[model samples]
Target: MPPCQSSQSFALDAIDSLVRCGVLITEENPEAAPVCDFWKKKGSLKWTTTDDPYHSDSDCEEQDLCSYKISQPSRCPDMLFFLCSMLAGHLRTLCWATMALDLMNTPLAEAEFVRQIHSHLWNTANQKKQYYESCSEEAAHTAVRTLIDLGVLLEERQTGGVFLGVSPLFQLSENRQKLHYFITQYLYS
Candidate 1:
């Protein structure tokens, strides 16, 4: 099977198992709504009125699941750049991510870095009412965590202090320029 198809099948099976095991309550379940919404937005799941509730067939024509495929070792930076571009589509996330990148050169403590990003997001949300109203500190934390999970950010603890920096995987000048362009186009424009 194609990689994307296999990924879709695996996701469907996992969701089915979760639902069957009562781990995920679909009906009137507030917690599951976000999970469902995310999958639906990603075109991995669909809701059908006539069929058996949720449909497994995804119509995500623009969804390129193969973007993460690294056919050559030299293409790693390209993959990371693609991932960042995807995240740039979400304004609030782009703000948090780019703010992290901006502060990468500063020798601030980890907690201070997170605090600064949260403050920046909160202030921006206040100024831009139409974009987002739920840019809470928790959201900032989640964005930072996501960057870390994606290997775009790194955290190290030493006797001097806790250091946070962009991962070496994304430290290339070309990648930095592309990321800055994304910030300008998506966040400012």
Candidate 2:
């Protein structure tokens, strides 16, 4: 629900910013319009965009006319950070393992990532989907490579195909905590 509210705020902020920046402006205010109608009443000569060119803040007081404006959070945040923390190390580890086994560091577009993630799930479970004719070969290859690079799983290039090298780190019964420790140390360092 909070994320939904953020999305709504982002959308309205976007519209106001767009109109203010002259990226997208309405020629005439509609009856159902939410935009500031001062421009329609006055003229374009009276408006001035604020001083900052890089970031947008539309609180200019010099002009009576303006594009629609809204107060936006200076740096809008996403819910993913909270969600990721809730997952903690275990979830990141799981994702790392699965992604390594499928397609690590493979530059796939967002849609491709979703599709590859589903395929990775199937592969990890060793289950076959009815329609599973093929999977994202590139993503899978990339994941295996990532696993190797991250030392999560060792890899051996052999005849016919690649085989997993034994990973003493992951093989331990206390692998999760150990992995968390190592990952934190490495990432933080």
C-alpha lDDT of all candidate models, in order:
0.54, 0.42
Over 1-189, each residue of candidate 2 has an lDDT whose tens digit, in order, gives 356465434654556565565444444323532222223333332333333545333334454333432223335333334444554433433444443322434334433444555466446445533213223444445544555554545555555455564254444435534444444432210
Clash-forming residue pairs, model 2: 100-143, 102-140, 103-139, 103-143, 104-142, 104-143
**For every model shown, what is its TM-score relative to the native structure?**
0.43, 0.28
Q: What TM value does model 1 have?
A: 0.43
Q: Identify the runs in model 1 with alpha carbons over 4 angstroms from their true place.
A: 1-91, 132-134, 177-189
Against the true structure, whose lDDT is highest?
1
lDDT for model 1 comes to 0.54
Model 1, 1-189: lDDT tens digits are 456566546655665554554443444333333221333443544432222555435444442221111132342535534654555435555555565565456445778777877777776766776545436667777777766654456788889788767766457655555554544653433
**What is the clash count for each candidate, in the order shown?**
0, 6
